[model samples]
Target: MDKNVLFQKFVAFTAAVHQTTNEITKNVKSETITPLHYKILEYIAVSQPVTLSEISECMHMSMPNTSRELRKLSEKQFLEKVADDEDRRKHIIRLSKKGEAMMNESFQRIESRFIERMEHVSEEELKEIERALDLLHSKVFN
Candidate 1:
């Protein structure tokens, strides 16, 4: 295959995935829950008791900005900050029950949308897409 054609196809695929994800996330966003808020929730949900610095690094955001978002989410009762036993100055953040429920609902919405879109695709084609995705993952990450 021509490398230029391959690159173009990859770019198109990435654009489509980004667009679909944005659309799904837009559907889930609320007054207190913007797309960025959902991203923060996702990071915290995966890494509970995480520190502010850790979240900042993971999100590729500055400490001040991360702190601001955390405060907003806390105000919304999505998460809470507790003093880290290891260090008095640093705090650990964890999602509240409300946060977990919200995250679960958002993920369910995205998954259901994906499933709805895939319903028209044949099983064999789905399997092939899965295999291709796995290959891409392995190539990119490993």
Candidate 2:
């Protein structure tokens, strides 16, 4: 399977993606939240109406710590905690309008940057990239 070659390619791919993305994402900052909090917000932006336990597990944080951090975001009006309609005992968390705007701001920059980067790529290669991404998502990342 050429596992080492595959691993090296993934490492290089991620390093390249992260190099630009990290800088573009840096613009989403606030005096009220730290980088960790920003990451939590960013994660929520992608996976909204998420639950506390899901965030905790995905963020690799303890339940208490996740709750505490979410409380801080909630206080700042960046997120909301609503009772789950399907499961009354559960609480679902979602980004407030402010948080959505914050993430969208960075998203525009990132999208523009990627578009510029892909300008040199041929349409056939772009199709190949799309297929590769789909395969990776379905088989490896899923």
**Best by TM-score, which number?**
2
Residue-level lDDT tens digits of model 2 in 21-78:
7866666566667998988998898888799999999999999999999999999898
Evaluate all candidate structures by whole-model CA lDDT and list the values in order: 0.87, 0.87
lDDT per residue (tens digit) for residues 117-138 in model 1: 8989999999999998899889
Provide the global lDDT of candidate 2 against the true structure. Answer: 0.87
Deviation from native of the Cα of residue 45 in model 2, angstroms: 1.2
Worst 10 residues of 2 by lDDT: 23-32
Q: Show pairs that collide, candidate 2.
A: none
After superposing candidate 1 on the true structure, give the runs of residues whose Cα lies further than 4 Å from its correct spot. Answer: 1-8, 46-51, 57-60, 82-92
TM-score of each: 0.74, 0.83
* TM-score of model number 2: 0.83
